[model samples]
Target: MRGMTNTLTIGERVAWYRRRRGMSQDVLAGLVGRTVDWLSKVENDRIELDRLSVIKNLADALDVALGDLIAEPSLMEWVADSGTKTIPRLSAALMDYRLITPVSSPSPIAEMPSLVSLAQEVDELWQAYQASRFGYVTTLLPETLSRCQTAVEAYDSDDQVQARRLLAFTYQLAATQMTKIGEVELAWIAADRGLAAARITGDPVAIGSLLRSVAHALLAAGRFREAMQLIQDTASYLDPHLSDPSPELLAVHGTLFLTGSMAAARANDTDTTRTFLKAADESAQRIGQDANHVWTAFGPTNVAIHRVATAGELGNVQVAMDLGPRIDTSALPMERRVRHALEVARAYSSWNRTDDALSTLLAAERIGPEQVRYHFLSRQLVLTWIKRQKGRPSSTLADLAHRLKVLD
Candidate 1:
């Protein structure tokens, strides 16, 4: 098994680790409360292990880090130096409390990022994120967050409120990016910070928008029940304003419903899922057009996209296959489009349409390579395809896997 870590599939790695630990298949299987036959099929890669909870159980049984079995290549290996340094700096920025109290002498006001420039840059970063330019956003996030903190302290009255709003929005973006890359704990921290800032602004729209981030991080961390509760509570809190809602408020409310739908779907609560989806659709109809108000991308088209996604999450692949292809996603942002494409690919994979699945994945990569590269769905689908391949994978499949760093 020497040097196999870089090339072995997750199942193979599990086998290697089990053997190295002097454990039998029966012993390992019993430890994880799985049958030996199930363990055998898992080791042979006959079944793909995609669920994080199941993988965590296996890792615990094997006495390995979850990353050891997942083997996701470092972001730096694919993007560059920024990956190694970005997270720590972002953490420091998140932890810095100088804005709350003078921890040390603050940077000179002249040295701080100007409010006007910071607002513009915040919008630009959100645009970059929606366009799936994640690596670039990660590189800039630490400094931008620090600047928002500084702006809150430097300004006063209305300017301070505006600064706090920007700070909340920036933290929302950070939480979103962290969730995308599997940094769930950090994502939660960012979401908490965003919500705290939003509360200080006393803006319902700002608070509502941060609720989306908080719910998103919760979903990523598999806390579906808590996520749904938060969404429901936020929706109730914003209900009074919806009678004569601004576009921003409508978008934020609609986005909260969409997140709720996802949480319900993942929790396998069909009734709640339908209810949330219906609410999202009603909000979309009221909005009248596809728009990115409050950066929620809430509209009829986005609601449709989420319907397909929720179906996929609930194992209604037939519905996803039926709805996913007919919808024109060209009008949506690259993030939503790529995400829908990945769901379509998942539908195809589950339907055993390997060729269609691979083609869809390839097309999604062409449009958003970074998004596909870091996404768990794409990685698992590609790994399953590799396992299902007999003699050897075609050059295209091999190339994609190599580029995704699933193979050394």
Candidate 2:
């Protein structure tokens, strides 16, 4: 096992570890709450092992750290090649400010840009973020944050209000990017700052937006109950405007419901998930399809995509796959489309259609390489696929694994 660790798939590693511990497949399976046949498939690399919870359970049953099972040199190489430094830098920035201190002291009053220019810049940054141009966002965030701080300090009261609003939205963008890169703590800080600034601006919509961002961070951190409560409370507070909903109101409202549904799904609360999803669907119906209001992209098509995602999350693979055919990827933005495809790939993997899953993932990569390459789950899928091959993997799969840094 030690000699072949570099070449062995995850299933082989699991079997090796179990055998080294002198445990039969039946014994290990019982400890992990799985049947022997399931264990055999996993050991033979006939099935993909992608779920973190399942991995953790296996690690515990095998008396190993979770990282001991997952850490691989190839994956490290991929991370290095990915150039994903934004999350760490953002985390450092958040730690520097403690989510309380301003980003920086003001420049001289004369050096500050006018509120109009600042607002325009903010719009550009917002557009970049919504377009999923994360590298561009990383390039712009430091200067934009500094400028926003300077404006917040330099402006008079009336103008300062708008300046703070710009600052808040800028921080919200930071939060969104940080979350995408798996920097949950940094994302939380940025979202909190956005909420603070939004409150100062007295804009209910901005507040709602920041709340949604914070809830996202919470969800990523696995605080599903807290996330659900936060979103539900905020949604109720903002419900008054639903009767005469502006696009912004509808977007936020729909997004909040969507977030609530996700949190509930994570908690295995089917009733709550159904209720929130129903409300979101109704909101989407009213808004029609493909609306990118506030970059939430809350509309009928987006709702359909989430339905598939929610079903997948709840372990209803068939339901997720059944709903997948109804989704119109053409109506989604590039980022959303990539995500939908990846979710379908996950469903295929769950259904033991490894070839279909790999094809789906590769297709998504072709459509948006950055989106696919930088995603954490993509590496897992690639590694699992590599392990499942009985002999020499096809050149196509091997080449992708090498490109993705999951194979030597």
Candidate 3:
């Protein structure tokens, strides 16, 4: 501490600003509407803070002020905010670099990134997720969600209906991905938030989409009755009498009923399953020609995956296996495409085809460590069956079971 009021280098100032806001470089990027790499450079004094709007956005996102952000705060502030305080040895250098920036020569500025439109950024993130590039997905998704949430908070002030809709939809997307990792509770929370926001906007399409999300969470949690009720209620809300009801809206609602039916079958309530399926099929027909509506759930591929799960549950392994090969993998994102292999594993295991089952399971595991979920349940099922057949499973399967942490 020795210049002006105290000595703080460029790195020091950047680090201080980060601390002042109690943000990590990643979180700072989220606040400032920049990428992590860019924020890191800025903190290292390798980049300049050129965007006033971004700086203001950062303050808003961090719930802080621009001047306080310039104070000589310590990295401890960030640690405190992160709900932890032990400074990692690796992080020891950020402080030193911080103290050095004000007293030493400034680090050279990095080349600025080309500005991309918000939709373009979203498109890029979606593409990365589609590729199953988990590193990129996890890295950017938080920031994207932050931006969407921030936009949602400000949507009313801007008087933009479309922007509000986008914000609500983005939350639904976050909830869907959260459920992939078995965070069903959080996913449901997000869906509820989105539902409230959609209702505020009086957007039937948005509300229907959020309802489908809630339906997915309920269906997966084995709440068949509740899921059915939700779908039925959503149908009533949609008011099919609209002169040009969106095919996208109808398709999603139809898919919700299909999900409930599948859940019902899993519960062994065949009558309920049949009833829901009949309603779903009827609604599916009302969703006419537009196959690419982001909300429409109509592709033959979507139908195939649901068919496999339902048939497998109904003890019709042959039907599931038969439909498995007909699914169009090219039409789905990696997250859902990887689910096809899960269905394959189930169908093979059901037929007592040990080798085929193992192969499918291993293949799915190889491609989808970070992309898919619920493998532990499948592994447990196979291992239990194996143990029942013999005193123990094969050594190889036993080892696999251990790796998967299953009862087998």
Candidate 4:
């Protein structure tokens, strides 16, 4: 009777085990001789799991014992507060990696869209990312990536050069989205591919932008020293162009410096952090206060936001708090605004201001519920706050935890 009452639905257990093994539905479907769409339906409870043989096959494909699928851990908590679509969609997008290959010969120009059209499509993808419409981005990325890759390989003349630039930026957008969802290895691969495309284009500015994307993935993967070395190596080439840099070049350069500053802060190199932050400040001042570049939001206000983040990472809670209110985040995108609020929440947590931390986190949630609900840091903060409460938590906190799925 206990087992009957406690058993996880086949869909829930299947999804949990699949994610635990880091296998996408595409991969699992191939292993089990099924279509991804079919597997998705099963995982979403659209179909019954009544066939014992099929269940066994799924267990084998997932490399888990069949019994494991019948019963999940009773104590397993922290189910995602948001819809289950995000990670699965990301995984599906990454499956397109196998389709990308080097183009050996150019296709006829008449068969492909113009270079300007391809570039505009890539820019539209970037806009989707900036607006934090990740679901729509997921829908766009596979076709965009395929189209860009084809354009790059198909053009034979000066148009080919521009096509390569567009392709490189498309890959950078993929890397950015991958990194946002904590898929660092996939992000690294995308960034490296973008760098290769940029190098082929022979554009220093594009190469610099791809390098910053690579550095971001490295930092996310906890390779701080490697990330710092990358920034150092690439900065030398790009720094010379600063004298009369285009706004594009300045945005990339400023973003690189800001990334380097954050990496240094994470590595506990305070002096290096300060040096990079100051350099970034100079670049931001030159560029002024706007998200002028389509690919990056690295202007004065954005730089100020990173300074607060850097201070927080360095364990300077009071200092971060002091600087937080001075920076106006209105010019930034929704993603940046939510991140700044989360950083301030982190500082509040560090200072043992539990109520302040909760308030800040709630504000961030209101600003971007999808981001807060899916972010690992937000989950950890809510869990920690709940554990630290004395006796019964306030009704608001209790309701918040339940909504966040930090408590069942």
lDDT of 2 by residue, 205-301 (tens): 7889999999988876666789889988998888877788888778888888998888888777779889999998888888876688877878887
* Order of candidate numbers by lDDT, starting with the best: 1, 2, 4, 3
Backbone N/Cα/C clashes per model? 0, 0, 6, 0
- In model 4, which range of ten residues has the least summed lDDT? 72-81
- Candidate 4 segments exceeding 4 Å error: 1-111
Candidate 4 lDDT tens digits, 1-408: 112322244555688889988998899989989999998987865554433345656877777654455432122122233233444554565555444545544434456767788888888778767666655665567667777767876777888888888888888888887777656667887798889999998887899999999998987666677888888888898977778998888888888999998888877788988999888888888887676584787888888888898887777778888998567787788788888887878777767787998898888878676566545456556655665566878887887777665566
| lDDT-best of 3 and 4 | 4
Q: Best candidate, TM-score-wise?
A: 1
Error of 3 at 73 (Å): 38
What does each candidate score in C-alpha RMSD? Answer: 3.5, 4.7, 20.1, 12.8
Which lDDT tens digits does candidate 1 get at residues 110-164?
6756789999999999999998888888889988888888898788999999999
Tens digits of per-residue lDDT for model 3, 1-408: 211321232334556656766678887777656799877775554443322233434545656543233322222212111233222321232123532346765333243212234445655655655555434443455555445444544445444455556656665665565455444555676677667667777777777878888887775444556776787787777766345766766676667667776666655566776787767666656664324455343544565577776766676678888987577765666666677776777677666676887776676666664443233234334444444454667776666655554432
Please tell me which predicted candidate would have the highest lDDT against the true structure: 1
- For residue 128, give model 3's deviation from the true position in Å: 4.8
Judging by TM-score, tell me the better candidate of 1 and 4. Answer: 1
Q: What is the C-alpha local distance difference test score of candidate 1? A: 0.84
Each prediction's whole-model lDDT (CA): 0.84, 0.76, 0.56, 0.73
Question: Which regions of candidate 2 deviate over 4 angstroms?
Answer: 1-89, 98-110
- CA deviation > 4 Å runs, candidate 1: 1-43, 49-74, 77-85, 97-105
What order do you get sorting by TM-score, best first? Answer: 1, 2, 4, 3
